[model samples]
Target chain A: MGARRETILETIQQYVDLVATGSSADVVALYADGATVEDPVGSEVRTTREQIAEFYGALDGLEQSARLLHTRIAGNEAAFAFELVTKAGEQTYTLAPIDVMTFDDDGRILSMRAFWSGEDMLVS
Target chain B: MGARRETILETIQQYVDLVATGSSADVVALYADGATVEDPVGSEVRTTREQIAEFYGALDGLEQSARLLHTRIAGNEAAFAFELVTKAGEQTYTLAPIDVMTFDDDGRILSMRAFWSGEDMLVS
Candidate 1:
């Protein structure tokens, strides 16, 4: 909770950017040592660093672009809506996920829970 | 987590609607008897029905309009961003609060945590 507002916001942006243009390690680096990730909410949580990195490994290489639609930073927790577009050959799939993250005093993410499902995806 | 996606979404809409135009009791009715509300995340958690109603009492009689910008329902939980505009005399104040709620089988909200702070408010 000691993190400044700008610090938290910057981390969120960095997270989105890294997922779009960087390696899985880049995204995993944003989390604290004991962080957990539950992308899509109901999935099994990724607790260890190796597991967390593996979870993001799906985005290691792809034609994707991301942007933050809206964000709310409160205390050490943040909830944000973001858009991600993945291009595969002739089809383009878009999904907007609302991610909730709790951060530590050091500004590293403590836990991340994303609110999204296949029903929310749109392909064009 | 027994609630359907549609039911959860409907309850969220009803909540926003009641806050904008109905009485505090009307809004409190959407919650389960044991529901808890932690507005702005860092504030005190309101647990009892009377306490929760008291927290929302500030909006009992105000000229306000509310709308949901975007929402995501996963499992029995939903997270969304919405805007509330209050008009007093010639002044207008607006706030976009991102709310995360967990619903029961009957679609009654069990816990609602709002992710917003005073820094997110604006006046014009």
Candidate 2:
């Protein structure tokens, strides 16, 4: 929905919205073709366009919100500190951590590496 | 001593050596022009080539070692988790935090943002 480097901040916000709305395809488009996501508990999840579409399809009745606390941008990379409050199935989880996101010069998110602790997830 | 991208890891290692040896000039060259350094206590220190050289000239005696615990690289960006053990003036300080370094396509470090706590600095 936005051009390169012009709406980077908004692009990330859009992805957050998609997650909250349980729309994974929208979230996945922000990434480059060969994109990867790492979970808090040292899990590496690779995503393809089709896989992302299917993953979101499974989270049918989930409600989620990603609250952005702070954002720092320099050149082609941006770091965001955010909290994810999500309710999937019958339980809710809250995760607060900082994530480093790298964008290609064209503003497409090339990779996203999230940093958080498993202890926090367990407590949440 | 290395080419762009080929020795990104070695380049950072070299900077760590310069710090340990109190060779500020060598450390300063790793930064791009108009580079900035921030302290854990919320101080933004911008450095120019000349200022860095002068600063190193003053540190006649110092011993330091930046032991890298982990490094993650993706595309043109790299993040390093390291501990800086230094003895300067009559004091020794140990700072352990992960720093995100962005390198230009040419392998020159454009920006480095280190994430550490001020509390750690005071204790060390």
Candidate 3:
């Protein structure tokens, strides 16, 4: 009954798609102005748009595909697990991160925390 | 350098197993003295031993089975997806709730927040 869950779910899917195929700005657009992003949980949190954009910019020219595995949405927060396979020259890496996010009334992400560490990554 | 992820993982598995086969006291033992539990994100949070015991009392004397599906552990926090199947006489209810939790240094659960609503439940 907070933010529309349908809209939030749609936004999550859009986020995953953007992370896979869209630019850094496209991915950052899903977040509100003061939103914070902490990728891999224990890492330093990125607060500024430039920092967040740079974090996502790492995927700009990478060959990657993302697939959402499980999602649980309640109230104004959602935790979803997605698998990302990325190719860097001759190496392929796969990482599945479960992201917890809080959304604003308009379905813009307020904060995003990813639950995964380097040990969870698989290189092939 | 907080709580060991392996220990926390084992504790989570123990929790799911106890919720399926043990009593309320068994489940409550996993929590710290001032732990908080919010079974569903929007619901009221339960604190104190008596209140927490009362919350888990609902699972008592019911035919149930639980299986953990996905887990992501980072630092002293973990987010896991689990499947719970309960049978009330001729009716069967299945719910898959993704639970996010933080653990203390001793691996005791400090806070447990489940992300699932009645809409996510299935009856057969």
Candidate 4:
């Protein structure tokens, strides 16, 4: 891979790692000031930095772990498929989603859209 | 890769190949009867088979080609990133989109959602 692509992948991996480790602050720091996030593909978009931070912060309570399954990089965009396992209360849930994220020249995330549905999740 | 993952990838690759070769009918054949398609992430969803066929039919005119960049499969879902090059009139355009597709047990496509925007395209 080229250096630029390597950098983009590293940024995405860092985001995934932070999320897995429950570092909400660091996750929010990876985005650009006016970056937008739309989780679950069809939901309302979160535009402001504060809103984006809030979205990430919501994951704080859940015992979550993520495994990167695939990564594709082209230009300043990277799309990854990951499996997320979360333990909430006495239940454990698994979700597999494909998140397409675009980065700015400075490597900050510009937009994040996750494609997944209720049908994509499993509970145990 | 497991046998099931291999099958899913083959199905996705065949769909891409049909699109690249301008075989709209064959592309439509890959989907189930009530499949849906939402191109460009957020658009009017095409639900009926006729509408889905018509959507693929629209791609027949342009000299189009696609290259699969990445593929990920988990359960009955697969998401892939690909580069689409199209020659329209005297101009050539390139679009890179990540499309998340879900399939039924019979290997027929259930839904296709493409994640891309004007910012993700290039023209020459």
Model 3 chain B scores worst on lDDT over the 10 consecutive residues at: B1-10
Task: Score chain A of each prediction against the true chain A by TM-score and list the results.
Answer: 0.97, 0.75, 0.96, 0.93
Residue-wise C-alpha lDDT for candidate 1, range B1-124, written one tens digit per residue = 3888888889999999989998998999999989999998988899999899898898988999999999998898889999999999999999998999998899999999999978899999
- Listed per candidate, the RMSD to the true structure in angstroms reads 0.9, 10.6, 1.0, 9.6
Cα lDDT of model 4 by residue, B22-85, tens digit: 5789999999888999885547899998888888888886788888976656567777878789
The number of the candidate with the highest DockQ is 1
Residue B103 shift from truth in candidate 3, angstroms? 0.3
Name the candidate, 1 or 4, with the larger lDDT value: 1
Lowest lDDT 10-residue stretch of candidate 3 chain A: A1-10
Q: Comparing 1 and 2 by TM-score, which wins?
A: 1
Q: What share of the true interface contacts does candidate 1 keep?
A: 0.87
Candidate 3 has which clashing residue pairs, if any?
none
Candidate 2 lDDT tens digits, A7-110:
66776777666766745666777777776665431454656667655655665556777777655454455666666787767788887665677676667777
What is the per-residue lDDT of model 2 for residues B1-124, given as tens digits with 9 covering 90 to 100?
2235456677677766666674666677777777655433134554666755565556546666777755545445566656678776788888766567667666667766765544436333
Candidate 4: give the clashing pairs: none
Candidate 2 DockQ vs. native:
0.06
Error of 1 at B73 (Å): 0.6
**Model 1, range A63-119, lDDT digits (tens) per residue?**
999999999999999999999999999999999999999999878999999999889
Model 4 agreement with the true structure over A63-103: per-residue lDDT tens digits? 88888976656567667878889998889999878888888
Least lDDT summed over 10 consecutive residues: which range in candidate 2 chain B?
Answer: B37-46
